[model samples]
Target: MNETENDYHGYTPMDYDEDSAADEAYQTCVSYIVEHAPIERDDTVVDVGTGTGIVALELASKCDRVLGRDIDDEWLRYAREKAAERGVENVSFDHGSFREPNVEEAVDVVVASYALYMAYDEGGEGTLRAAIEGISSLNPRHLVVADKMFFGPPEPRGGYETLPRMGTVANLLADTGFTLTDVEIVSGSAGVLVASRTSG
Candidate 1:
């Protein structure tokens, strides 16, 4: 199950069951972000590559607004539908890539859960640099990133081999002018990092 073969775009369902592992992972990532990043009520957040409103909707509950951005129209529609179903008024879904998020205002926080590394893997160096720059342009106070960590072998996922190590990710954030605040790697080989802008 190389990454190309098991890519979410190819095989993973657009939506996950309420209690499935995928849903749990989403919840776990959101929980970690909320705990470490601590969004304020007056803050606006952007959940980049937010599939099905998982992180976006959750952030909406704690912030003034949340924009869920993704390149997949189907996933965006599903996120919109889910937000409507939950009567979550502060959350909005939009079709966009992380490299060019098209957000209108400076957001207080930007979160990418299991999404940024995928952009790095698929789009290569240029995309990753663009993504970092795009996020920086938002002038976010905090940036929370959550993605898988390969401890040994490339766990059957297509691009795990290309996924940057946790330290490498931290270095990238530093290069983009963010200060690393906290980091944690879960037993499941997934990790979360929180970084803050010096001026923010």
Candidate 2:
């Protein structure tokens, strides 16, 4: 997993699920990403930071397939078990990080929830740049990022070092052939960004 401001090492998969279920802002981000993303019925989607595969599983019903990639094995195991229990055959969780998302085929859309800041924490903007580029390589037409990124000035609830500003994030996406199309601020320190692939 990318270096993160908070660690999930102590929490069981069920515990993580319960906490995220209780977090209104986090839920808002997930909903906003799904609602705003330009996904088609036949599209294949890749969730770059699929912690417990929540976002990936959510998108599975709407899209043809969803591949949830994360670096955490425990989380993937739990996610897969949940998928089985729910009979969600269209979604799968596998090991991957933002910079190396092990995507074997092309995808129509890409989504990331609360993972980009961890990229920054791992190696600053440099790592984030690589992560964006990596996602771009999948040839997705649309990208949605929901995380504790700043839509305004850094807030007290977020860390200055890890909370990336929207402007910087947009510039990095632009460098990778994307145009920042829309934004939804879910809370003081959390938001969603919708970007579309565009010619440079």
Which regions of candidate 2 deviate over 4 angstroms? Answer: 1-9, 157-161
**How far off is residue 44 in model 2, in Å?**
0.5
Per-candidate clash tally:
3, 0
* Residue lDDT tens for model 1, 1-200: 11112345543334353533556655676688767675899999998878767778777868899988887676677788888899999998887666678798878998888777765676665666677777778889888987765533446656344665666667778878898888776634577888998763
User: Scored by CA lDDT, what does every candidate get?
Assistant: 0.73, 0.84
Query: How high is the lDDT of residue 148 in model 1?
Result: 62
Which regions of candidate 1 are displaced past 4 Å? 1-26, 123-126, 150-161
C-alpha lDDT of residue 18 in model 1: 51
Model 1 C-alpha lDDT versus the unseen true structure: 0.73
What TM-score against the true fold does each predicted structure earn?
0.83, 0.92
